[model samples]
Target: MSHPRNTLRTSTFSCTWCRVSVPVATADGGQRNHCPACLHSRHVLDQVTGGPSTCLGAMSPIAIAVPRAGDWTVVHRCVRCDELACDAVREDDNQLVVMRMAVRPLAQPPFPLEAFGTL
Candidate 1:
């Protein structure tokens, strides 16, 4: 089935199992949308990010997460489409990345998550 064409530019989507925003791919000049670091995606084949596609396969995470988190989410860059996105470490996500991302605290706190939380 084809996805609806919404007026808004941002297509509200996330990992089917994790329910988190899949990163928009920039490696191909922002024409892909796969999760880097984790190499996972929702299989939304497109010439650009936030678009529609017929491929519905859940892009699996084949790489490691770089431990970048937001207010309550962790970022991953996909190896497939080179998409850079964030997931909140869901139970449904790959156990390895989930466990690895869980250690974000050991990192530098992931940018300005605290600042965004107050907003």
Candidate 2:
């Protein structure tokens, strides 16, 4: 018996920051774009062109954004190219890390907090 030449193979990518092997898909069958543990991603896809990117920079999670639709997305910044990207939050993602990013703005506000007390 001869086997078919056309076969799909399992694919995985290593996290640029955490160095963890992440599956291409999540447990709920959703596509994974970043690591669940460290939440870091590789700049391998161009958001504007929707094609493979040549930057290959390490993307760092900067903030968490919640839109009116009630969906949360993690905002990342490319260390090399300074590009910005967003990825959906997975169920298996670390809650502590996500919370930290969410409260970062309040924790370290751009303006001094004493200004509010004067009023």
Q: Candidate 2 at 83: error in angstroms?
A: 0.8
Off by over 4 Å in 1: 1-39, 45-49, 53-71, 91-97, 104-119
Which runs in model 2 stand beyond 4 Å of their true positions?
1-10, 112-119
TM-scores of all models?
0.30, 0.81
Clashing pairs in 1: 23-84, 23-85, 35-77, 35-78, 36-76, 36-77, 36-78, 37-77
Error in Å for residue 32 of model 1: 20
lDDT of 1: 0.49
Candidate 2 has its poorest 10 consecutive residues by lDDT at: 1-10
- The prediction achieving the highest TM-score against the true structure is 2
In candidate 1, what are the lDDT values of residues 1-119, reduced to their tens digit?
12336434544445555566643334333433444335356655443556775556565543344445433345444445555444444433346665665564656665766678678
Candidate 1: clashing residue pairs, number:
8
Instruction: Give the whole-model CA lDDT for all candidates, comma-separated.
Output: 0.49, 0.86
